[model samples]
Target: MSVHAIFLSMLCILLGLAKPSSSATDTFVFGGCSQIKYAPGSPYEYNVNSILSSLVNSASSTSYNNFKISLPGSTKADIVYGLYQCRGDLSNSDCRDCVAHAVSRLGVVCPGSSGGALQFDGCFIKYDNMTFFGVQDKGVVMKKCGPSIGFDSDGMTSRDSLLGYLTAGGQYFRVGGSGNVQGVAQCVQDLSMSQCQDCLAEATLQLKNQCGSAAWGDMFLGKCYARYSSRGDHSRDHDSHDDNDNDDEMQKTLAILIGLIAGVALVIVFLSCLAKLCDRKGFFHISSKEDPHSLKAEIQEDRYIEARERK
Candidate 1:
């Protein structure tokens, strides 16, 4: 093949390999749609689409953004308010991808709803006809507690300390570890600092009061969430064993994927080096005979020397 053809082929292969992995960040946590539905071709639907597009576009530049959409002739009731917030640590590209995915998912999960909300592990998106911006909503949306292993005073103390540290932070997102316990807390950026603190405080309090003695716990309120996990706690249940097995399988899958990607990258590099060598030697035309001075013959000789040197 020509050098240009080979380069194009490699480019295609690299592009295929460039597809991002399905991270835990994109995992669906919870979502809900309003009971009210909009007309099929109404102004409300148009505004919803516009606001969702704004969210997807803005996510590429910022981790948190809110948009309000109202057409020139649209009424107050037709206005759409929407917002998306990615996890603080995610890169802009990841944030953009996550928001796009969430937008697509919201359509499928809550089609034509006047208002809807979706929360993934990495981000949150919400839109509505009525205003919810800068609102303080402490209502519990979701709560999960891992299987209890009875009461361990030390473990509970560590969890409490870690949670306290998370609540004390003034940032929109906070993470900390204490002993064997690790915890994270975050609030939507629309809230004031004090409101964010109050929301996290409420979430952590729920985790403590409701998830007592559990190895892990999650409490998600309307505008904030808190979660914690303690190491070295194993549940004595068949389900927990199954969960552990699933985790192990996931790890194995990730390892195999990484290995394959590395192998492909090495192949691309080798091919690129070979292309450069061929260009330098003006060996565009393939030679059928095993001429000693040919590119193929030289490559083989170099490999032979390398193998011998490795011994």
Candidate 2:
């Protein structure tokens, strides 16, 4: 076979074998511990763990994907309040998975802080010794900005449009945009509609102040999240909540399919060339009795006469 044929066959085989298996990915976005620390193995630590366990259990088993629970201790000081909220775009299973990861990460990152907030791309988790449910925490736990891009009106305008849609009858959670500016904003479920809007607005203002020229930015506050990207789909407009997720998944599936098809096509071409080579080498010689008048028979007769004359 030609060098090209052999190389193509090997490449195809490698591609076929290299298909990636579907697996869970970590969704950790950010996390923080309160300045207050609890003694290791103290009753307070035990209480926190107990509260985390309940939150995790409820998150895993619930269909709503938003839940808050409080565990009262023997003394009021041991009481722990916790809650988890999944991004509206996530499916039930995805929400659960994100919450589970967030909860586990909180233990490692915050340890015994009386109050800790764990945020993921798909969910948010927080716990405190003091009650925080229904109360908006104006504290800014995390703020991030994408690298600076040339600033223009589209960036701010698109972000504001997206936020407006979210606050005004966008179910308090929304994803939308146009051109190169797309964004989403969401609030914890315990908050009222107005409270959700206020929290998102506050977060958006913070992002504007900190990352006005950024290609993308996000602000994770006590009870809400607001973000926009000037360069990515987060900035691009979408028809629905899951549109972005579905688009990503579809793109991935298409890439794998294209790879598989290209690999298979290369393999078929290589095999065809190999078969032609084998035929020329007489590995599949025609039977004389089956086709006595065939081209191979005439060539063999000429070869026999030439050999006799040489003898």
Go through the candidates in order and give each one's C-alpha lDDT. 0.86, 0.71
Runs in model 1 deviating more than 4 A are: 1-21, 232-311
Q: Write the per-residue lDDT of candidate 2 for residues 1-311, one digit (tens) a residue.
A: 86556656766665565454322324456787898998886677877777777666666555233333334444677677778877777676776777777777887898668889887777778887787778977678788887786767776677666656655653657877766677888888888888887887788888878987777788888888887876555522222236557757766776676577667777878888998999999997775567656776889999999999999
> Residue by residue across 1-311, what tens digits does model 1's lDDT show?
75456655755665565554576567788999999999998888999999999999999999999989998778888999999999888899989999999999999999989999999988999999988889999999999888897989988898999888899898999878888888778899999999999999999999989999988988999999988887532111223567568767766765676567667767878898998899789986564575757776878999999999999
lDDT of 1 at 237: 25
Top candidate (lDDT)? 1
Question: Which number leads on TM-score?
Answer: 1
TM-scores, each model vs. reference: 0.71, 0.62
Q: What lDDT is reached at residue 224 by model 1?
A: 97
List ranges where model 2 is wrong by over 4 Å. 1-25, 39-43, 61-73, 154-156, 235-311
